[model samples]
Target chain A: MASNEEILAGLAEIVNEETGLATDAVELDKSFTEDLDIDSISMMTIVVNAEEKFGVRIPDEEVKNLKTVGDAVNFISNAQA
Target chain B: MARKVVITGLGATTPIGGDVPTMWKNALKGVSGAHTLEDEWVAKYDLPVHFAARCSTPALEVLSRVEAKRMDPSTQFGVIAAREAWADSGITEIDHDRLAVAFATGIGGVWTLLDAWDTLREKGPRRVLPMTVPMLMPNGVAAAVSLDLGARAGAHTPVSACASGTEAMHLGLELIRSGKADVVVCGGAEAAIHPMPLAAFSSMQALSRRNDDPEHASRPYDRDRDGFVMGEGAGALVLEAEEHAIARGARIYAELAGTSVTADAYHITAPDPEGLGATRALKAAMFDGRIQAEDVVHVNAHATSTPVGDKPEYTALRAALGAHVDNVAVSATKSQMGHLLGASGAVEAVLTVLAVYERQAPLTINLENQDPEIPLDVVTSARKLPAGDIVALSNSFGFGGHNAVIAVRNV
Candidate 1:
């Protein structure tokens, strides 16, 4: 099992694929576009990654509520729980 | 015969510049915004493409950190451009019910999506960001612009792939002409320069990879053309009914004369090789404008430079306009700005209106040798149009075989 930090690091690979930015735990608090320069289409890739990783598909209705990294992490955690 | 919709004000945040005036100035000067991207993933993942057209002017420069943190780059751009358009209209007092917004994007929230994925994969899902969805919605731009303008009429988004933005404009025209709203802030936005899309497009060979020379990679209509260069930004226009605009003393740029849209229903990413869908759209638009085909001498073409994509537009024009096609001078602005995907049409429409208003059609850049098969008078150099005001048409086609046309004439 991975530590929370390891889990976050695993998530970074997803962000890296979507954003083209290979970030670390230090950059997790960063806004997607500002600190990391990720664009809109990249977010869709993240949702897809979370869905596959957590085995829970977030629907379009709930997808609109996500705005930050924490939101995605919480959504996945809650689903996995 | 019916109510006419006209452009009152315009705004844009593009790769070359931010705001309407700056963007227009840079566009006329033929500035190239494409640059080689430096990212760790390029080395780690070994992504094929090495460059993209990032906004020379970022939205954050005009927005606060708090404001910037809330929206995706696409929505941030929409709000920035919309605010500029509203201020440019010189209408300080507006009735909320009479105002509306229509902003569309091909893809949205990519950054948020990917970042959230990273949070879940490594951080055990509990550490994922909270605002992922809000930042990534496809209608985020429409929501932002509508809120900024206090637009009560409605906020609509038409996501028809690359044609999304132009479709939004056409919808805005319909809204005003149908008496639903007196004014509409309309445009398109896109921010998809991330590695996944880059890799996806690269795999499809839909992007230019001449990494050595980013500036000349987006060569449309040239015999050596390979693929388009992805670009990011937004373009917006303020449109109003002639009566409302005149009563409010708004400066009318040009009349939204007519518009038409059609779908190929053929290929998901390719046009009807014969230009069937495009021909129908052009004919309908010309008929709607109530103008003879001869009157339209200029076209702000949607030439994305993909070898297969550039030729069909010319074929469609020749089939649709026949003899009039020879007299038409096509301006492929994508030649300079790469392709803004969904926002390309709206940006070109804004440029076309300026061309008509200024009586100077900016030439297609990077067109050293035109393809011999494309039999039309493409304006290779910026030239002043001859006397006499006339109707001009804007065409936008999307990946899903969706197509839209808009006609503008001097008021």
Candidate 2:
């Protein structure tokens, strides 16, 4: 299983690819909708791409809980374990 | 009095050129945009017709990665052309509520739709991108343009196959005349140069099979012409009310004198051999513009180089103009740039506006032996028009027997 840092890096990469946001700016404290300014459609795209990258199933219902970068990283790390 | 609508700015990302000036210059010089298809799908599928006129410059080169990712290729072309048109119009300030967009597409987001289907089949439903519906919708281009320009008056999409683009212009004219919008961006875009469209069009015998000589494949009015060459691109025009244009000190290209659209109700794929519907559209357009047959000096014919298609357009012209048809200098532009489908009418409208404004008609290349049936004076080379109040017609006919004709008068 990957560590929390690795999951955060992978998720940030997906967000960067989808939203053209700088990977470094996608820190744990940054919110996907507020800080990153990612819309719902883009958020879905990021989630799917993140699922594929991290080899985890990010269910549609679980997407709303991934509000911040840390929330997504923790979920992905826990799911992979 | 009805408000006069004029073409204030023009833009196009065509097979021959990336912008209006370049497209216009190359058209006059008789440049052919058709070439052999380089896609692996051609060899994989072993398609019969293996050539198309793709955009000279890819849309990704101009649009940002994020922007290009969200939009399908068709919407990308439309946005590129619309941005150029908006910038060309030099209108920095306008009430967002008074601006409108009437963009069209014959086949919208084919690439996105097919890709989504492929993803669904291979990777299951979860893999399908969420933007598929928004991108695949026929009005996607119009919506994208509306969002980009903040046009709130209306974002309309008129899907009439190849006549879609010209119909957008017609709708824009009406919008301004009815005092609905002060500025209306009208255009059509098409990017269906995919393996499925190529195969489908080939099956229907609508595409030319001159694989060996792709350059001369689209020879409109030529006796040896077989069929049209498929092309992909977009064309846009910023149309504003005459008084508004003057008050803003905008450079008016020409007056959008009049427009008319009709249906044959005769055939779904084939035009009426008698050309009755097209003839009525032509005559009605002239009447709407208050233009006499003698006043019309040029025509941008909807001659897609198909054997049957070329003759019917001539029949319509002859019926509408009578003997004066012999005097009109006609240019079959598809001969050079190939057929742009829905975007054909809009691009041809831009060319027709330039023809009237510059008093010169672009050449129609590869016409070695003009078909006797189409006895209209086809402009085989750059030709000059009379230096007076002149009017020109840009004709576009689509499948489903739709005919749209627009008249542009010199300002």
TM-scores for candidates 1 onward, in order: 0.83, 0.99
CAPRI tier of model 1:
incorrect
* Per-residue lDDT over B1-411 for candidate 2, one digit per residue giving the tens place of the 0 to 100 score: 688999988899999999999999998999899999999999999999989999999998999898899999999999999999999999999999999999999989999999999999999999999999999999999999999999999999999999999999999999999999999999999999999999999999999999999999999999999999999999999999999999999999999999999999999999999999999999989998999999999999999999888898899999999999999999999988899999999999989999998899999999999787778899987699999799999999999999999999999
Give me the candidate number with maximum DockQ: 2
Which 10 successive residues of model 1 chain B have the least lDDT summed?
A: B123-132
lDDT score at residue B403, model 2, on the 0-100 scale: 97
Q: List candidate 1 segments past 4 Å from native.
A: A1-81
Per-residue error (Å), model 2, residue B146: 0.5
lDDT of 1 by residue, A5-69 (tens): 65466678777655545556324466655566655555655776767765777775776666666
DockQ of predictions, in order shown: 0.04, 0.86
Candidate 1 residue lDDT tens string, B148-229:
7789999999999899988998899889988899999999988888889899989988999888898888888888888999
lDDT of 2 by residue, A1-81 (tens): 788988888887888788888889989999988999999999899888988888999999999998999999988888988
* Regions more than 4 Å wrong, model 2: none
Candidate 1 Cα deviation (angstroms), residue A12: 28
